[model samples]
Target: MVRQELVARQLAEQITEHFFHGNGAAEARPLRVLDVGCGQATQVVRLARAGHLVTGLDPDPVTLGAAQGAIGAEPQQVQQRISLLTGEGGDCGRWFGPGTFDVVLCHGVLMYMPEAEPMLASLARVLAPGGMLSVVVRNGDALAMRPGCAGDWGGAIEAFGTDRYTNRLGLPTRADRLEPLTRTLSEIVVPLRRWYGVRVFTDQTPDHVGPPVDGRQLAQLLDAEERAGRTDPYRAVAALLHLVGTRPG
Candidate 1:
């Protein structure tokens, strides 16, 4: 969906901005970033362009190859900033030494795993002290937001009764509340910041809201949405929740 794409882009921008701000770098250096389950490597490309040493790890060779192609055509300097690896999500421990990366991104991939604890632990382990972890997952509280918006109160209630939501593709998707996910970090002794809701207003709109609009308008709208996402009321309805946490130094 257009909204979903916008949310992903916004999240990426937020993460990049925070990283640069925290490091006080004109260009990020000694920066090691891992994108777990980085399908097609879009995030990988963005990080590389930002001058971070990026590694994209995924289980699918085909997807990894596609990502490689995507990154390969960039400026040579950007190309040199990235490395691609093929591996399962939980294999972080085997491939990365302890305290190796400044940032670890595990986005959209957490819902697929039956258990998130191991992956979280592995991510915490690889993160350099004072490093951050960015995670984006389905917003569990928003299960009712869509159905209620569509005037399907009964459907919304039924959906909220369950642990997860089903997509058009018939795949089961689980959502997580901000508190619970932050609590998980606490269990591991990681400190969590406030969560941002992604796609709050956009998700309620029809998939094809209108014909492709002006690029600048689109950008403005995404910026507004992202700003709203960080606040109260609006955040509750976001289709996805983004939480950031840091490993202790």
Candidate 2:
């Protein structure tokens, strides 16, 4: 939960800065947002509560039910602003017309797809002109960091030449390299805008360990992580990448 919270908070900050902060039209209007593969709907509810018109889709009924339950806790108006559906990420274009959403989120979803281009193409189809598309994926360039730091030299060594890695769930999964993904985004007509690394130093930290209880210490830790995520050399070796792209007309 702590790690997830960190990622969510960073995403919110970037979205605010890049999409809602300086844009005059977006500032005056409620942006239309879509969250593909929105597991548990925590972030979806957060965005809806912030007054965006949000639609979240996930293939799992249990997760969609959990999201619905979360949305139910909000005020009626906020709940009305949210829509949840049982669907996969690849069906986004089929579910919505082109240029339907101003901001599209597909965090933690691409890693599961053996081939990501189809889903990327679908996501691009739904984004409006100048719309933002935020993606979060396991970083292929730094795939060996966790295992190498944990002293799994062999596993870390093997990770260097391939994008395949076993996740904490012990399942075979894929990672995305920044350069290749940047190219794909361009090909899809959504070029990369800004990106940050997630879990730069904390990736090797045990999940059992929680964030600092003291306010000052917690702030300090978060501050350091946030800085490392944006700075060079540090971000170059993070465990995950948070990328933002914009569709240019």
Candidate 3:
């Protein structure tokens, strides 16, 4: 889960800075955030602790139950700042009116979707004017990287022609290319703001491999990873893409 934590920390820092550090009306602190498919409410708890009002929605009752348990373990004030619901990504409009949230997060959930445009439209519909939308998805452009690095020549060869692949969980899943998604966001009125690569070099690592035990080494590794995530040609082939969009006010 080290990689997941890294992604979360980076995203949280960016969101906090974008929403809390500016004086303009667009930069509002203590904003309302919606986390779609918020498994276990990891980001929900973090944002709530930072004083943002956060709501987490997940389709799985068990996941929502666990998220509720996590919230219960926090201080009463933090717990009170969060609300949970059992729902799907497309249910955004059904549960909240337009302009309900300043930040809408839909991370690590798009890979399971058969199609992303419809869901993106729904997510955009509920976002407040000038709000930010964050999405994380498998990188279709680099589907061959992992297999190629692992010496699965056949798999690598096949990946080059397809955006479909089996996930770490052994389930068939889809990926998204940066260019196509950028256009899709533009068409939906939430033009791309900024994006970064995630797990650029660690994509092929075994899931059991985690952070180093030494603090210094772990810190240095994370620094390198963060740098590579934002740097040029290196980021282009990352296993995952983190894209942010802004809705015009």
Candidate 4:
């Protein structure tokens, strides 16, 4: 969905702000970033273009090949800033030195893992002290939003109660709430912020709404959603949860 992608971009920008603004940190020191399970490496490429050294790690060779191809197609300056590696998220410590990166990202990858704790622990291990860790996951609570909006209240309730939903591809997927996610990471790092992403209003919109929407309007909607995501009454309906954490300095 366009809205979901917009929301992800908004959250990624927020994570960048948290790293650059809140910490008064220089982008040049320990400037390296790792994008765990970075299929196609879009975020990795974007960060590299912004002058940060980026490494995209994925277990799939096919995906890594695609990421390399994408990077090679970019301008030389941007291409020079990124490297793609084949590796599992939980095995990052073996390939990357501990405390080697200033920012670590594991987005849209954890839901597929049978266990999140080990992967999250590896992420924390690679993060430099005072560095940031950004995570994006499917929202457990939002399982009801689609069904209810589609006029199937009973199905929505049942889905929420069952704690899973089917994607457009008809694959069964699981969601996670903020509480448990925070708790799991807190065991290894300190959480800085928790926010809802792709809030209910945006998630329920059908893909065929119209022609491509204006970026300015999309930005405006994202700004509003970002503000609302941190508060009650709205956070509960978000389709994704974005959490930012930091390794103790």
The lDDT for every candidate, in the order shown, is: 0.77, 0.86, 0.87, 0.76
Give all TM-scores, in the order shown: 0.87, 0.92, 0.93, 0.84
Model 2 segments more than 4 A misplaced: 21-28
Give the Å shift of residue 5 in candidate 1. Answer: 6.9
lDDT per residue as tens, model 3, 112-191: 99988999999999998888899999999999999999999999999996889999989999999999999999998999
Q: What is the lDDT of residue 82 in candidate 3?
A: 96
Residue-wise lDDT of candidate 2 within 1-249, one digit each (tens)?
555666777767767776667454346467899999888888888788777899999999998888888888889999999988899889886799999999999998998999778999999998999898989999999988888999999988998989999888778899999999999999999999888898998887676778879999888888888889889999989898988998876
User: lDDT winner among the candidates?
Assistant: 3
Pull out the clashing pairs in model 2. none
Order of quality (lDDT): 3, 2, 1, 4
Model 4 worst lDDT window (10 residues): 21-30
Off by over 4 Å in 3: 22-28
**Across residues 33-126, which tens digit of lDDT does each residue of candidate 1 receive?**
8889888888788778767898899999999889989987899999999998989768888998988888888988888776567788888888
Which one is best on TM-score?
3
> What ranges in model 4 sit over 4 Å off?
1-19, 22-30, 206-211, 215-220
User: Over the stretch 106-197, how does candidate 4's per-residue lDDT look in tens digits?
Assistant: 88887877667778988888899888888888887678778888899898878765556776557776677778888987898657564556
**Using TM-score as the measure, what is the rank order of every candidate, best first?**
3, 2, 1, 4
The window of 10 residues in a row where model 3 has the poorest summed lDDT is 20-29
Which is the better candidate, 2 or 3, if ranked by lDDT? Answer: 3
